[model samples]
Target chain A: MRHTINLFLMLAAFWLLNSGHYSVLMLSLGLGSIVLILFIAHRMDVVDHESQPVHLSTKLPSYFFWLLKELILANISVVKHIWLGNSSISPTLTTVKASQKTDVGKVIYANSITLTPGTIAVDLVGDKIMVHALLEENIQALETGEMNRRVCQVEN
Target chain B: MDVAIEIMSAICLLIGSFLCVSGGVGVLRFPDFYTRMHAVGVTDTLGAGMILIGLMLQSQDILVIAKLVMILLMTLFINPTASHALAKAAIHNGLKPVLDNKERNNTESESSSR
Candidate 1:
Protein backbone atom coordinates (compact mmCIF):
# COMPACT_ATOMS: atom_id res chain seq x y z
CA MET A 1 0.00 0.00 0.00
CA ARG A 2 2.78 2.38 0.89
CA HIS A 3 4.73 1.71 -2.24
CA THR A 4 1.60 2.00 -4.33
CA ILE A 5 0.78 5.35 -2.84
CA ASN A 6 4.34 6.51 -3.41
CA LEU A 7 4.18 5.40 -7.01
CA PHE A 8 0.83 7.08 -7.50
CA LEU A 9 2.11 10.30 -6.02
CA MET A 10 5.16 10.24 -8.25
CA LEU A 11 3.10 9.67 -11.41
CA ALA A 12 0.55 12.29 -10.39
CA ALA A 13 3.20 14.89 -9.76
CA PHE A 14 4.80 14.17 -13.10
CA TRP A 15 1.43 14.28 -14.82
CA LEU A 16 0.49 17.55 -13.26
CA LEU A 17 3.71 19.07 -14.45
CA ASN A 18 2.88 17.91 -17.97
CA SER A 19 -0.79 18.90 -18.06
CA GLY A 20 -0.35 21.70 -20.56
CA HIS A 21 -1.56 19.95 -23.74
CA TYR A 22 -4.02 17.43 -22.37
CA SER A 23 -7.79 17.94 -22.37
CA VAL A 24 -9.56 17.36 -19.04
CA LEU A 25 -11.05 14.04 -20.05
CA MET A 26 -7.85 12.81 -21.64
CA LEU A 27 -5.89 13.89 -18.60
CA SER A 28 -8.06 11.93 -16.13
CA LEU A 29 -8.25 8.77 -18.26
CA GLY A 30 -4.60 8.79 -19.23
CA LEU A 31 -3.41 9.55 -15.73
CA GLY A 32 -5.85 7.04 -14.20
CA SER A 33 -4.55 4.19 -16.34
CA ILE A 34 -0.97 5.19 -15.69
CA VAL A 35 -1.59 5.13 -11.96
CA LEU A 36 -3.34 1.79 -12.22
CA ILE A 37 -0.45 0.24 -14.17
CA LEU A 38 2.03 1.70 -11.75
CA PHE A 39 0.09 0.25 -8.81
CA ILE A 40 -0.05 -3.17 -10.42
CA ALA A 41 3.62 -3.16 -11.24
CA HIS A 42 4.47 -2.21 -7.69
CA ARG A 43 2.34 -5.04 -6.30
CA MET A 44 3.99 -7.56 -8.59
CA ASP A 45 7.40 -6.40 -7.34
CA VAL A 46 8.43 -5.61 -10.88
CA VAL A 47 9.71 -2.22 -9.83
CA ASP A 48 11.36 -3.25 -6.64
CA HIS A 49 14.33 -1.68 -4.85
CA GLU A 50 17.02 -3.44 -6.80
CA SER A 51 15.56 -2.57 -10.18
CA GLN A 52 14.79 1.09 -9.56
CA PRO A 53 16.53 1.93 -6.34
CA VAL A 54 16.65 5.62 -7.01
CA HIS A 55 15.70 5.81 -3.34
CA LEU A 56 18.98 7.49 -2.76
CA SER A 57 17.46 10.59 -4.33
CA THR A 58 19.48 12.95 -2.20
CA LYS A 59 22.76 11.82 -3.70
CA LEU A 60 21.45 12.47 -7.20
CA PRO A 61 22.55 16.09 -7.36
CA SER A 62 26.09 15.15 -6.48
CA TYR A 63 26.07 12.34 -9.01
CA PHE A 64 24.85 14.73 -11.68
CA PHE A 65 27.72 17.06 -10.86
CA TRP A 66 30.26 14.28 -11.23
CA LEU A 67 28.71 13.05 -14.47
CA LEU A 68 28.64 16.58 -15.85
CA LYS A 69 32.34 17.07 -15.15
CA GLU A 70 33.18 13.85 -16.93
CA LEU A 71 31.01 14.75 -19.88
CA ILE A 72 32.68 18.13 -20.23
CA LEU A 73 36.10 16.55 -20.14
CA ALA A 74 35.07 14.04 -22.76
CA ASN A 75 33.83 16.81 -25.02
CA ILE A 76 37.11 18.67 -24.80
CA SER A 77 39.16 15.58 -25.54
CA VAL A 78 37.12 14.89 -28.64
CA VAL A 79 37.56 18.45 -29.80
CA LYS A 80 41.31 18.24 -29.28
CA HIS A 81 41.53 15.05 -31.28
CA ILE A 82 39.71 16.63 -34.20
CA TRP A 83 41.79 19.82 -34.25
CA LEU A 84 45.22 18.67 -33.18
CA GLY A 85 45.90 15.13 -34.29
CA ASN A 86 46.58 15.28 -38.00
CA SER A 87 47.24 11.69 -39.07
CA SER A 88 49.02 10.32 -36.06
CA ILE A 89 46.85 8.26 -33.75
CA SER A 90 48.03 5.20 -31.90
CA PRO A 91 45.58 2.37 -31.37
CA THR A 92 46.07 0.17 -28.36
CA LEU A 93 44.19 -2.93 -27.26
CA THR A 94 44.77 -3.90 -23.65
CA THR A 95 42.88 -5.46 -20.78
CA VAL A 96 42.35 -3.67 -17.52
CA LYS A 97 41.39 -5.54 -14.35
CA ALA A 98 38.00 -4.73 -12.95
CA SER A 99 38.04 -3.92 -9.26
CA GLN A 100 34.35 -3.56 -8.48
CA LYS A 101 32.51 -6.46 -6.93
CA THR A 102 28.91 -5.93 -8.05
CA ASP A 103 27.53 -6.43 -11.54
CA VAL A 104 25.94 -2.98 -11.54
CA GLY A 105 29.22 -1.37 -10.55
CA LYS A 106 31.06 -3.12 -13.31
CA VAL A 107 28.47 -2.13 -15.86
CA ILE A 108 28.69 1.46 -14.74
CA TYR A 109 32.47 1.40 -15.07
CA ALA A 110 32.25 -0.13 -18.53
CA ASN A 111 29.72 2.46 -19.68
CA SER A 112 31.76 5.28 -18.23
CA ILE A 113 34.85 4.22 -20.15
CA THR A 114 32.87 3.95 -23.35
CA LEU A 115 31.36 7.38 -22.76
CA THR A 116 34.76 8.99 -22.68
CA PRO A 117 36.61 9.97 -25.84
CA GLY A 118 39.45 7.90 -27.34
CA THR A 119 38.68 4.78 -25.28
CA ILE A 120 36.26 1.90 -25.70
CA ALA A 121 35.78 -1.14 -23.53
CA VAL A 122 35.43 -4.04 -25.96
CA ASP A 123 34.61 -6.92 -23.66
CA LEU A 124 34.21 -7.20 -19.94
CA VAL A 125 35.20 -10.66 -18.83
CA GLY A 126 35.60 -11.91 -15.28
CA ASP A 127 37.69 -9.33 -13.42
CA LYS A 128 39.26 -8.02 -16.63
CA ILE A 129 38.11 -5.76 -19.46
CA MET A 130 39.53 -5.59 -23.00
CA VAL A 131 39.65 -1.93 -23.96
CA HIS A 132 40.41 -0.36 -27.34
CA ALA A 133 42.02 2.98 -27.03
CA LEU A 134 42.67 5.54 -29.76
CA LEU A 135 45.80 6.68 -28.03
CA GLU A 136 47.99 4.97 -25.44
CA GLU A 137 47.49 8.11 -23.36
CA ASN A 138 43.78 7.41 -23.06
CA ILE A 139 44.55 3.92 -21.80
CA GLN A 140 46.89 5.42 -19.23
CA ALA A 141 44.14 7.80 -18.16
CA LEU A 142 41.76 4.90 -17.45
CA GLU A 143 44.51 3.24 -15.42
CA THR A 144 44.21 6.13 -12.97
CA GLY A 145 40.84 4.60 -11.91
CA GLU A 146 39.21 7.91 -10.98
CA MET A 147 36.13 7.23 -13.11
CA ASN A 148 35.76 3.72 -11.74
CA ARG A 149 36.18 5.00 -8.18
CA ARG A 150 33.47 7.63 -8.68
CA VAL A 151 31.02 5.11 -10.11
CA CYS A 152 31.61 2.71 -7.21
CA GLN A 153 30.88 5.55 -4.84
CA VAL A 154 27.59 6.14 -6.65
CA GLU A 155 26.61 2.46 -6.71
CA ASN A 156 27.27 2.17 -2.99
CA MET B 1 16.19 37.06 -19.79
CA ASP B 2 14.24 34.99 -22.28
CA VAL B 3 16.24 36.45 -25.10
CA ALA B 4 19.46 35.74 -23.27
CA ILE B 5 18.49 32.14 -22.73
CA GLU B 6 17.59 31.73 -26.37
CA ILE B 7 20.83 33.23 -27.48
CA MET B 8 22.90 30.96 -25.29
CA SER B 9 20.96 27.94 -26.47
CA ALA B 10 21.51 28.91 -30.07
CA ILE B 11 25.19 29.39 -29.48
CA CYS B 12 25.44 25.98 -27.92
CA LEU B 13 23.62 24.40 -30.81
CA LEU B 14 25.89 26.07 -33.34
CA ILE B 15 29.00 25.01 -31.50
CA GLY B 16 27.71 21.48 -31.18
CA SER B 17 26.98 21.32 -34.89
CA PHE B 18 30.41 22.68 -35.65
CA LEU B 19 32.02 19.98 -33.57
CA CYS B 20 29.98 17.30 -35.28
CA VAL B 21 30.90 18.63 -38.71
CA SER B 22 34.56 18.97 -37.83
CA GLY B 23 34.55 15.45 -36.47
CA GLY B 24 33.14 14.09 -39.68
CA VAL B 25 35.73 15.99 -41.64
CA GLY B 26 38.44 14.60 -39.41
CA VAL B 27 37.20 11.08 -40.02
CA LEU B 28 37.53 11.65 -43.76
CA ARG B 29 40.85 13.46 -43.68
CA PHE B 30 42.59 11.46 -40.98
CA PRO B 31 45.39 9.16 -42.03
CA ASP B 32 44.08 5.84 -40.76
CA PHE B 33 41.20 4.02 -39.17
CA TYR B 34 42.52 4.44 -35.62
CA THR B 35 42.90 8.21 -35.97
CA ARG B 36 39.46 8.42 -37.53
CA MET B 37 37.95 6.57 -34.60
CA HIS B 38 39.49 9.07 -32.22
CA ALA B 39 38.01 11.95 -34.18
CA VAL B 40 34.58 10.40 -34.53
CA GLY B 41 34.22 9.20 -30.94
CA VAL B 42 34.97 12.55 -29.35
CA THR B 43 32.88 14.77 -31.63
CA ASP B 44 29.80 12.55 -31.77
CA THR B 45 29.27 12.32 -28.01
CA LEU B 46 30.08 15.91 -27.19
CA GLY B 47 28.29 17.37 -30.18
CA ALA B 48 25.15 15.37 -29.56
CA GLY B 49 25.20 16.08 -25.84
CA MET B 50 25.53 19.79 -26.34
CA ILE B 51 22.75 19.81 -28.91
CA LEU B 52 20.42 17.94 -26.53
CA ILE B 53 21.14 20.30 -23.68
CA GLY B 54 20.51 23.20 -26.01
CA LEU B 55 17.16 21.78 -26.99
CA MET B 56 16.26 21.15 -23.37
CA LEU B 57 16.87 24.76 -22.49
CA GLN B 58 14.64 25.92 -25.36
CA SER B 59 11.66 24.17 -23.78
CA GLN B 60 9.76 24.73 -20.55
CA ASP B 61 7.14 21.96 -20.62
CA ILE B 62 7.47 18.93 -18.41
CA LEU B 63 7.00 16.15 -20.97
CA VAL B 64 9.53 17.76 -23.23
CA ILE B 65 11.94 17.85 -20.33
CA ALA B 66 11.30 14.18 -19.59
CA LYS B 67 11.90 13.22 -23.20
CA LEU B 68 15.05 15.27 -23.26
CA VAL B 69 16.21 13.50 -20.14
CA MET B 70 15.46 10.18 -21.79
CA ILE B 71 17.48 11.21 -24.84
CA LEU B 72 20.42 11.99 -22.60
CA LEU B 73 19.95 8.66 -20.85
CA MET B 74 19.97 6.80 -24.13
CA THR B 75 22.98 8.70 -25.36
CA LEU B 76 24.83 7.97 -22.15
CA PHE B 77 24.22 4.27 -22.52
CA ILE B 78 24.48 3.63 -26.26
CA ASN B 79 27.27 5.87 -27.56
CA PRO B 80 30.03 4.20 -25.60
CA THR B 81 28.75 0.74 -26.41
CA ALA B 82 28.92 1.43 -30.13
CA SER B 83 32.44 2.80 -29.83
CA HIS B 84 33.53 -0.23 -27.85
CA ALA B 85 32.04 -2.59 -30.37
CA LEU B 86 33.72 -0.79 -33.24
CA ALA B 87 37.09 -0.90 -31.55
CA LYS B 88 36.63 -4.56 -30.72
CA ALA B 89 35.68 -5.37 -34.27
CA ALA B 90 38.69 -3.48 -35.57
CA ILE B 91 41.03 -5.47 -33.34
CA HIS B 92 39.33 -8.77 -34.18
CA ASN B 93 39.90 -8.01 -37.84
CA GLY B 94 43.59 -7.76 -37.06
CA LEU B 95 44.00 -4.01 -37.23
CA LYS B 96 47.59 -3.37 -36.17
CA PRO B 97 48.74 -0.42 -34.09
CA VAL B 98 50.89 2.23 -35.77
CA LEU B 99 54.15 2.16 -33.87
CA ASP B 100 55.50 5.52 -32.80
CA ASN B 101 59.12 6.72 -33.25
CA LYS B 102 60.26 5.75 -29.77
CA GLU B 103 58.98 2.18 -30.15
CA ARG B 104 60.52 1.94 -33.64
CA ASN B 105 63.90 3.13 -32.35
CA ASN B 106 63.80 0.65 -29.45
CA THR B 107 62.97 -2.21 -31.76
CA GLU B 108 65.72 -1.23 -34.20
CA SER B 109 68.37 -0.98 -31.48
CA GLU B 110 67.40 -4.35 -29.97
CA SER B 111 67.54 -6.09 -33.36
CA SER B 112 70.88 -4.45 -34.31
CA SER B 113 72.52 -5.25 -30.97
CA ARG B 114 71.40 -8.88 -31.24
Candidate 2:
Protein backbone atom coordinates (compact mmCIF):
# COMPACT_ATOMS: atom_id res chain seq x y z
CA MET A 1 0.00 0.00 0.00
CA ARG A 2 0.90 3.70 0.15
CA HIS A 3 2.31 3.30 3.63
CA THR A 4 4.75 0.66 2.49
CA ILE A 5 5.88 2.76 -0.43
CA ASN A 6 6.28 5.72 1.86
CA LEU A 7 8.46 3.80 4.28
CA PHE A 8 10.62 2.40 1.51
CA LEU A 9 11.05 5.81 -0.02
CA MET A 10 11.90 7.29 3.34
CA LEU A 11 14.59 4.74 4.11
CA ALA A 12 16.07 4.83 0.62
CA ALA A 13 16.13 8.60 0.64
CA PHE A 14 17.96 8.62 3.95
CA TRP A 15 20.40 6.00 2.73
CA LEU A 16 21.12 7.88 -0.45
CA LEU A 17 21.49 11.16 1.37
CA ASN A 18 23.87 9.66 3.88
CA SER A 19 25.83 7.38 1.57
CA GLY A 20 28.26 10.15 0.48
CA HIS A 21 29.99 7.96 -2.10
CA TYR A 22 27.25 6.99 -4.51
CA SER A 23 27.42 4.28 -7.13
CA VAL A 24 24.63 3.54 -9.59
CA LEU A 25 24.82 -0.22 -8.94
CA MET A 26 24.69 0.30 -5.19
CA LEU A 27 21.84 2.73 -5.52
CA SER A 28 19.69 0.40 -7.63
CA LEU A 29 20.42 -2.71 -5.58
CA GLY A 30 20.20 -1.16 -2.14
CA LEU A 31 17.10 0.87 -2.91
CA GLY A 32 15.56 -2.04 -4.77
CA SER A 33 15.98 -4.45 -1.87
CA ILE A 34 14.51 -1.96 0.55
CA VAL A 35 11.50 -1.46 -1.65
CA LEU A 36 11.13 -5.21 -2.15
CA ILE A 37 11.15 -5.91 1.59
CA LEU A 38 8.51 -3.22 2.21
CA PHE A 39 6.41 -4.56 -0.63
CA ILE A 40 6.34 -7.97 1.06
CA ALA A 41 5.50 -6.39 4.40
CA HIS A 42 2.67 -4.46 2.79
CA ARG A 43 1.19 -7.64 1.31
CA MET A 44 1.35 -9.28 4.75
CA ASP A 45 -0.43 -6.26 6.32
CA VAL A 46 2.27 -6.05 9.02
CA VAL A 47 2.89 -2.33 8.97
CA ASP A 48 0.41 0.34 9.92
CA HIS A 49 1.48 3.92 9.32
CA GLU A 50 -0.04 7.35 9.81
CA SER A 51 1.03 10.60 8.14
CA GLN A 52 1.77 13.89 9.86
CA PRO A 53 -1.05 16.45 9.90
CA VAL A 54 1.08 19.61 9.59
CA HIS A 55 0.37 20.43 5.99
CA LEU A 56 1.81 23.93 5.82
CA SER A 57 5.31 22.85 4.92
CA THR A 58 5.78 26.00 2.88
CA LYS A 59 4.78 28.09 5.91
CA LEU A 60 7.09 26.15 8.24
CA PRO A 61 10.02 28.46 7.54
CA SER A 62 7.96 31.53 8.47
CA TYR A 63 6.84 29.84 11.67
CA PHE A 64 10.42 28.92 12.53
CA PHE A 65 11.59 32.48 11.82
CA TRP A 66 8.91 33.82 14.17
CA LEU A 67 9.93 31.37 16.90
CA LEU A 68 13.58 32.35 16.46
CA LYS A 69 12.71 36.01 16.93
CA GLU A 70 10.73 35.22 20.04
CA LEU A 71 13.62 33.16 21.37
CA ILE A 72 16.08 35.98 20.79
CA LEU A 73 13.80 38.49 22.54
CA ALA A 74 13.34 36.08 25.42
CA ASN A 75 17.11 35.70 25.64
CA ILE A 76 17.52 39.47 25.87
CA SER A 77 14.95 39.68 28.65
CA VAL A 78 16.60 36.83 30.54
CA VAL A 79 20.02 38.44 30.21
CA LYS A 80 18.64 41.74 31.48
CA HIS A 81 17.11 40.01 34.48
CA ILE A 82 20.39 38.28 35.27
CA TRP A 83 22.29 41.54 34.96
CA LEU A 84 19.91 43.17 37.46
CA GLY A 85 20.73 40.40 39.96
CA ASN A 86 17.24 40.45 41.41
CA SER A 87 16.45 36.82 42.16
CA SER A 88 12.84 37.48 43.09
CA ILE A 89 12.15 34.38 40.93
CA SER A 90 8.39 34.65 41.09
CA PRO A 91 7.35 31.40 39.41
CA THR A 92 3.73 31.29 38.30
CA LEU A 93 1.80 28.33 36.90
CA THR A 94 -1.17 28.66 34.56
CA THR A 95 -2.93 26.80 31.80
CA VAL A 96 -2.73 27.95 28.20
CA LYS A 97 -5.08 26.73 25.53
CA ALA A 98 -3.39 24.93 22.62
CA SER A 99 -4.73 25.94 19.25
CA GLN A 100 -3.50 22.90 17.31
CA LYS A 101 -5.91 19.99 16.86
CA THR A 102 -3.34 17.29 16.09
CA ASP A 103 -1.43 15.58 18.88
CA VAL A 104 1.91 16.08 17.08
CA GLY A 105 1.20 19.75 16.60
CA LYS A 106 0.33 20.16 20.28
CA VAL A 107 3.51 18.38 21.34
CA ILE A 108 5.63 20.58 19.05
CA TYR A 109 4.01 23.74 20.46
CA ALA A 110 4.44 22.63 24.05
CA ASN A 111 8.05 21.67 23.52
CA SER A 112 8.78 24.91 21.64
CA ILE A 113 7.42 27.03 24.51
CA THR A 114 9.29 24.96 27.05
CA LEU A 115 12.52 25.32 25.03
CA THR A 116 12.39 29.11 25.38
CA PRO A 117 13.85 30.55 28.55
CA GLY A 118 11.46 31.43 31.43
CA THR A 119 8.71 29.02 30.37
CA ILE A 120 8.13 25.37 31.19
CA ALA A 121 5.31 23.03 30.33
CA VAL A 122 4.48 21.43 33.65
CA ASP A 123 1.63 19.27 32.42
CA LEU A 124 -0.82 18.78 29.58
CA VAL A 125 -4.52 18.59 30.43
CA GLY A 126 -6.36 17.78 27.24
CA ASP A 127 -6.25 20.84 24.97
CA LYS A 128 -4.72 23.09 27.64
CA ILE A 129 -1.28 22.83 29.24
CA MET A 130 -0.09 23.88 32.67
CA VAL A 131 2.93 26.07 32.02
CA HIS A 132 5.25 27.50 34.64
CA ALA A 133 6.88 30.79 33.73
CA LEU A 134 9.93 32.17 35.50
CA LEU A 135 8.60 35.71 35.15
CA GLU A 136 5.18 37.31 34.83
CA GLU A 137 5.91 38.80 31.42
CA ASN A 138 6.34 35.39 29.79
CA ILE A 139 2.91 34.27 30.93
CA GLN A 140 1.45 37.52 29.61
CA ALA A 141 3.01 36.81 26.19
CA LEU A 142 1.33 33.41 26.09
CA GLU A 143 -1.97 34.94 27.15
CA THR A 144 -1.81 37.27 24.16
CA GLY A 145 -2.07 34.19 21.86
CA GLU A 146 0.52 35.39 19.32
CA MET A 147 2.59 32.21 19.50
CA ASN A 148 -0.54 30.07 19.45
CA ARG A 149 -1.79 31.75 16.30
CA ARG A 150 1.52 31.22 14.45
CA VAL A 151 1.66 27.55 15.44
CA CYS A 152 -1.92 27.14 14.22
CA GLN A 153 -0.92 28.65 10.91
CA VAL A 154 1.65 25.92 10.52
CA GLU A 155 -0.57 23.10 11.80
CA ASN A 156 -3.38 24.07 9.42
CA MET B 1 42.28 30.83 -3.07
CA ASP B 2 41.91 27.22 -1.96
CA VAL B 3 44.88 27.63 0.40
CA ALA B 4 43.37 30.74 1.93
CA ILE B 5 40.02 29.03 2.38
CA GLU B 6 41.70 26.02 3.97
CA ILE B 7 43.65 28.20 6.35
CA MET B 8 40.53 30.04 7.43
CA SER B 9 38.75 26.73 7.89
CA ALA B 10 41.58 25.45 10.04
CA ILE B 11 41.47 28.54 12.21
CA CYS B 12 37.72 28.16 12.75
CA LEU B 13 38.10 24.49 13.58
CA LEU B 14 40.81 25.26 16.12
CA ILE B 15 38.70 27.92 17.83
CA GLY B 16 35.69 25.64 17.86
CA SER B 17 37.68 22.81 19.42
CA PHE B 18 39.07 25.16 22.06
CA LEU B 19 35.59 26.32 22.97
CA CYS B 20 34.30 22.75 23.18
CA VAL B 21 37.15 21.76 25.46
CA SER B 22 36.66 24.81 27.66
CA GLY B 23 32.97 24.09 27.92
CA GLY B 24 33.67 20.50 28.89
CA VAL B 25 36.10 21.71 31.53
CA GLY B 26 33.53 24.15 32.87
CA VAL B 27 30.94 21.39 33.02
CA LEU B 28 33.33 19.28 35.05
CA ARG B 29 34.65 22.00 37.33
CA PHE B 30 31.60 24.22 37.90
CA PRO B 31 30.09 24.34 41.39
CA ASP B 32 26.56 23.23 40.52
CA PHE B 33 24.52 21.60 37.77
CA TYR B 34 22.67 24.78 36.82
CA THR B 35 25.83 26.83 36.53
CA ARG B 36 27.54 24.05 34.65
CA MET B 37 24.60 23.88 32.27
CA HIS B 38 24.85 27.57 31.62
CA ALA B 39 28.51 27.29 30.70
CA VAL B 40 28.02 24.17 28.63
CA GLY B 41 24.98 25.46 26.78
CA VAL B 42 26.48 28.70 25.53
CA THR B 43 29.88 27.27 24.67
CA ASP B 44 28.52 24.20 22.96
CA THR B 45 26.19 26.23 20.78
CA LEU B 46 28.97 28.53 19.69
CA GLY B 47 31.47 25.70 19.34
CA ALA B 48 29.27 23.39 17.29
CA GLY B 49 27.93 26.15 15.12
CA MET B 50 31.37 27.48 14.26
CA ILE B 51 32.67 24.02 13.58
CA LEU B 52 29.76 23.28 11.26
CA ILE B 53 30.23 26.53 9.44
CA GLY B 54 33.88 25.74 8.93
CA LEU B 55 33.10 22.29 7.63
CA MET B 56 30.43 23.64 5.33
CA LEU B 57 32.89 26.07 3.87
CA GLN B 58 35.28 23.21 3.23
CA SER B 59 32.65 21.05 1.58
CA GLN B 60 32.70 20.37 -2.17
CA ASP B 61 29.19 20.70 -3.57
CA ILE B 62 25.75 22.17 -3.09
CA LEU B 63 24.41 18.85 -1.81
CA VAL B 64 27.03 18.82 0.94
CA ILE B 65 26.24 22.39 1.84
CA ALA B 66 22.55 21.63 2.07
CA LYS B 67 23.23 18.59 4.26
CA LEU B 68 25.48 20.60 6.54
CA VAL B 69 22.81 23.26 6.85
CA MET B 70 20.32 20.59 7.82
CA ILE B 71 22.69 19.35 10.50
CA LEU B 72 23.08 22.87 11.78
CA LEU B 73 19.32 23.25 11.84
CA MET B 74 18.94 20.02 13.78
CA THR B 75 21.48 21.17 16.33
CA LEU B 76 19.75 24.51 16.68
CA PHE B 77 16.42 22.80 17.33
CA ILE B 78 17.67 19.97 19.51
CA ASN B 79 20.21 21.69 21.76
CA PRO B 80 17.97 24.29 23.41
CA THR B 81 15.06 21.88 23.75
CA ALA B 82 17.21 19.24 25.42
CA SER B 83 18.81 21.66 27.86
CA HIS B 84 15.48 23.23 28.82
CA ALA B 85 13.87 19.84 29.32
CA LEU B 86 16.74 18.75 31.54
CA ALA B 87 16.53 21.91 33.62
CA LYS B 88 12.75 21.65 33.98
CA ALA B 89 12.94 18.00 34.98
CA ALA B 90 15.58 18.77 37.59
CA ILE B 91 13.50 21.58 39.05
CA HIS B 92 10.34 19.47 39.12
CA ASN B 93 12.25 16.76 40.97
CA GLY B 94 13.15 19.25 43.70
CA LEU B 95 16.62 20.15 42.59
CA LYS B 96 17.03 23.47 44.35
CA PRO B 97 19.32 26.11 42.90
CA VAL B 98 22.62 26.34 44.75
CA LEU B 99 22.88 29.19 47.18
CA ASP B 100 25.90 30.44 49.05
CA ASN B 101 26.78 28.78 52.35
CA LYS B 102 25.47 31.74 54.35
CA GLU B 103 22.11 31.68 52.59
CA ARG B 104 21.94 27.92 53.00
CA ASN B 105 22.60 28.24 56.73
CA ASN B 106 19.96 30.92 57.07
CA THR B 107 17.42 28.77 55.20
CA GLU B 108 18.21 25.79 57.41
CA SER B 109 17.84 27.81 60.57
CA GLU B 110 14.58 29.36 59.41
CA SER B 111 13.15 25.93 58.58
CA SER B 112 14.24 24.51 61.93
CA SER B 113 12.68 27.41 63.86
CA ARG B 114 9.45 27.04 61.87
Question: Candidate 2's residue-wise lDDT over B69-98, tens digit each?
Answer: 778777876876776677678877987655
lDDT of each: 0.72, 0.67
Query: How accurate locally is residue A35 in candidate 1, as Cα lDDT from 0 to 100?
Result: 69
Model 2's i-RMS, to one decimal, reads 6.1
Give the clashing residue pairs of candidate 2, or none.
none
List DockQ, one per candidate, in order: 0.37, 0.18
Per-residue lDDT for A10-95 in model 1, tens only? 77766665555577897888687786888689678777544455554565568667767877776676666667654345567788
* True-vs-predicted CA distance for residue A135, candidate 2, Å: 2.9
**Which TM-score value belongs to model 1?**
0.73
Candidate whose TM-score is highest: 1
Report how far off residue A69 is in candidate 2 (Å): 2.0
Consecutive 10-residue window with the lowest summed lDDT within model 2 chain A: A81-90
Q: Stretches of candidate 1 above 4 Å error?
A: A1-25, A28-50, A55-60, B30-38, B60-66, B85-114
Q: How far in Å is the alpha carbon of A64 misplaced in model 1?
A: 3.3
Q: Per-prediction fnat values?
A: 0.59, 0.04
